[model samples]
Target: MIYRSFLRPILFRLSPEAAHELALDSLSFFLGAAPIRKAVAARHRGWPLGPIKRFGLEFANPIGLAAGFDKNGTAAESLAALGFGFIEVGTVTSEPQSGNEKPRLFRLASDHALINRLGFNNRGAAQLAENVRRRPPDCVLGVNIGKSHRVAIADAIPDYLTSFTAVYDVADYIAINISSPNTPNLRELQRREPLAELLRALQERNDELAKDKSLRQKKPLLVKIAPDLSEADLEAIIEVALNANVAGIIATNTTVSRDNLHASPAEVQACGEGGLSGAPLRSRSNEVISLIHRLTEGGLPIVGVGGVFTAVNAWDKICAGASLVQLYTGFIYEGPNVAKKINQGVADILRREGFKSLDDAIGCSAK
Candidate 1:
């Protein structure tokens, strides 16, 4: 309430990207100390209906800060203190990237949306690993990896492998991102053969690393997909993931489609060539989650992202079949307290709806 009523308007005065950086920088700077993190967490703590166990890891709550917020893994502790059950950082590549031209991020205030073609800008995987190791979050941390902008589609496997190995140890789980619309030819990797090959290669490496490092088990591996996929495309992906023995799937990244927008064509056209995220992404994201859940028969865990601004929105995703939900544009619009409110609300909803646990609510609406 405070942020939207006052701080957001002030932050809104800046360019979208500038506001993002300023907010992130301010939070990290103020909460950088260990004692500060502990104090903040205590103050803003949210009650979860029950601990959520997914992909061989236990999440303190089911609400997580989605990837791209902390692209370099630099502010995990500060972000966690704001009440995210988990934090996913990066869409990191094998090498560092400056990303596309400035003004890459834009706001559609009327529609409560954002359009971004930032192209996975980050300080690269090695740096993210170093930051994570230096200041690990108090909650589960997942690292999302993508193809370096300069890496060709043909050499993507090696590129991803490099990043995969770099953050493998630091991340509690790893999310393979092949869905960002900003990068050229990146979505091509989502095709059946390419997707299968990539997952197989990474899984093989996962095994080798576990044995090589003499760890008890390999890390959980997940894939993030775009919300714009066709049902056939999703079915193909499910087959590939199951065949490759991947751990989970993150449904519905940002969308290229501009359907159901309140923004004028002129206003939207002015912000050309970027993925649209926020309220417009809700239905499609839930649709994908439902289909995947039904197709997989609840065998695979899913991390849902898209249009999650309120507990009702999060609950809709949960009912549709998401095992966990994430926030991005919602975090921007709803402010820092978004996670705490959503978490408590979900817990309340669970008790009201007669669910014994969060797991009972999963896929309940998938008829």
Candidate 2:
């Protein structure tokens, strides 16, 4: 009620990227202040329903702040206080590199969407690993890794491996991102042969790291895939993921397609070429999730995302078969309380439907 009525208007006044920075800055400031963080966390006590254990880690709630929202792990501890079950930080690379040019992020208010060609800009893996180690979040922390902008398709394995090892000590789970549209030839890593090799290498290292730390449990490795894949592509990817014994898959990152939009042609054109997210991405993203769910026969754990903005929207993804849910653009449009609202609203639906637990609700609609 407060966000749409008050906050959105003020945020909408600035450039999308600037507004995003401002929001993060505000959160960081509040989060940095102990009293503020405590007050916010106290006000938004996560569903006392209890922890959700998946991917070998227990989450306080199913709502997570998706990667791209916190690329540096700088605010993980503070953001954790706001009520996320987990925070996936970074699409961090081996070496630091400036992302695409400015004006890369655009807002399509009419569509409640965003188009960003951010290109994995961040402070690099080593820095993030240090940040994660120094101040880990209260909730689960998933580190999202990606290929460096300058790394070639052939050498992408080593590039990602460096990042994986650096953050392995600090991450509860790791998300391998090969789906961002902004990175050149990065999606090629999603091909069966390349993806298989990449996951094989990373998972192998994950095992070694577990032993090195004298820890019984190694961090779960998940793949973040693009939504534009064909059905055949999804099937092949599923086979490879299962063979690699990965923990889960983040069903989508963003889409390059611009078909069927409520925004004017001029407005859409102005946003230019980038991955489209938020309400406009709902149908296609859900279609991808359904395809994966059916092909895998609910075997694979999925974190459904893209275009989720309402409790009904979140519930739809949960019923469609997402073991968990995440949000990026929705957080932008809906404001800070978005996670709590979705969690509360979904809990209400689960009770009304007589679903005892979230796991029972998975694929209920698709079934």
Candidate 3:
């Protein structure tokens, strides 16, 4: 209520990207002090519902801050103090790039959505690793990697491998992002042959690196997919994912589609050529999570993300088969308290629904 009634009005007045940077910078400064960070964490951390164990890591809660929110790993610890169980940072490319031209991020206020073509902009993988090393988050950390813009589609595997190697030692898991619409031809990597090859190569490296480091467990690998795939495409991608032995699937990135929005067509079209995310993406993302759960028979772990804005939205995804739910656009609209509120709501709902644990509630709606 405070955020929406007071803070949001002032923050929303600035351009979307500018507001985002300002928020991040403010969090970084205020939370940079250890004592202040701890105080904030104490106040906001959700109740101690049982921890969620997925991909060999135990999450304090199922709600995570999705990738793209902290593209450079800056303010990650601050974000964690805000109550996210985990923080997936980066979509960091192997090379540093300025990204698409300015005015690339647009807000469809009426729709409570955003459209962005910010093309994997970051300080590059090496710098991100350094950032994480210097100020690791308070919770689990997943590093999301993408092919460098300069890298050709054909050379994507090696490009991704470079990033994977850089962040491997620090990340709790790695998210292979082949789905951002902002990057030209990136989604094409989702095609069966290429997708399979990419996952297989990454898995092989994961094994080698684990062995070389003498780590007891290999780092989990997850693939993030686009929301625009056809049924057949989804099925094929699932087959490839299973074949590659990846640990999990992040059921969505964002959508290129702009259907059924409350915003004027002209207003939306003006934001042109970018991925759309937020309230408009909820149903389709839930549908994709349900389909993956049904198809895999709940065999593969799923991280559901899209338009999640409240606890009910997160619960919908959990019941649709997502073992964990993440938020990006939702965090923007709902404010910093979103994760703590959602986590508490989920625990309440679990008991109300007569479920003993979250795992027990997974896919209840689908069943």
Candidate 4:
């Protein structure tokens, strides 16, 4: 309540990117201390049900901070203390590079949305892996990896393979991001030929690493796709994922299309080009989730993203077949309590609806 009514307006006053940096820095500063993290977590324990087992790992809660928020693995402890079930950090690359120029992130206040062409800017996988290794957080951490902007499309496999190995030990699971519109040709990897080679290579290495770790388990590999995919495109990707034995899919990432927006042409045009996310993305992303759920027939796990702003919105995705839900734009609009609220509300809805567990809510609408 206070976030949209009070804090959001003030933060929205600044440039989108700058405001994000300020908020992240402030949180990081506080969480860097032990006492503060414990104090914060103690107060926001949320609905402490038993551990949630998904994606071959246990999540303390179903709500997680999406990729692109903690792009450097910097403040997992702080974010976890805020009551997120898990925190996914980074769209890191094999090599570091400054992303697209300034004014790349824009706000569509009228639509309660944002358009960002931040280009997956981060400190590269090696640096991020080191950061995670040095001070591992207590909660589940998934690392999202992408190709370096400089890497050629043909060489993307090796490029992504480099990152897969780098963060293999640190991340609970690896999310292969093939849908960020900011990077040129990144989505091409979502195609069948490229996706097959990519998933196969990574899984081979995943097997090798599993042997290396013999003591520990092999981390699951998940692919994140765009919401704008055609049915044929989706089928091809699904076939590849199943054949390659990939763990799951994150459906979907931001969209370049600006259709069905509440913002006027002039106002939306003013925001220019970038991926559109938040309320405007809710239905389309949910549709993608449903399609994938049907395509896989509840066999493949999906981590839903895009436009989940409230408990109802999150519940919509769960009912449409998302095993777990994540949010980035919603966190920006609703503030830190978004995850806590969604988890608690889902628990309430589950009980009221006569569902025995969170799993019962999965695909209720679609089924």
Candidate with the greatest lDDT versus the true structure? 3
Alpha carbon lDDT of each predicted model: 0.93, 0.89, 0.94, 0.89
TM-score of 4: 0.97
**What tens digits encode model 1's per-residue C-alpha lDDT throughout 313-347?**
99999999999999899999999899999999999
Q: Determine the backbone clash count of candidate 4.
A: 0
lDDT of 2 by residue, 309-352 (tens): 88899888988889899999988988888888888888888899
Candidate 4 C-alpha lDDT tens digits along 55-111: 678888888889999888877768888888888889999988889988899988878
Error of 2 at 46 (Å): 4.0
Worst 10 residues of 3 by lDDT: 43-52
RMSD of each: 0.8, 1.1, 0.7, 1.2
lDDT (10s digit) by residue, model 3, range 1-367: 9999999999999999999999999999999999999999998877467788998999989999999989999889899999999999999998788899989999998998999999998999999999989999999999999988888999999999999999999899999999999888999999999999998889999999999999999999999999999999999999999999889999899999999899988998899899999999999999999999999999999999999998999999999999999999989988999999999999899989999899999999978
Rank the models by lDDT, top first.
Answer: 3, 1, 4, 2
Residue pair clashes in candidate 1: none
The CA lDDT at 53 in model 1 is 84
Summing lDDT over every window of 10 consecutive residues in candidate 1, give the lowest-scoring window: 43-52
Q: In model 3, what is the error at residue 33, expressed in angstroms? A: 0.5
Clashing residue pairs for model 4: none
At residue 52, candidate 2 shows an lDDT of 92
Model 1: lDDT equals: 0.93
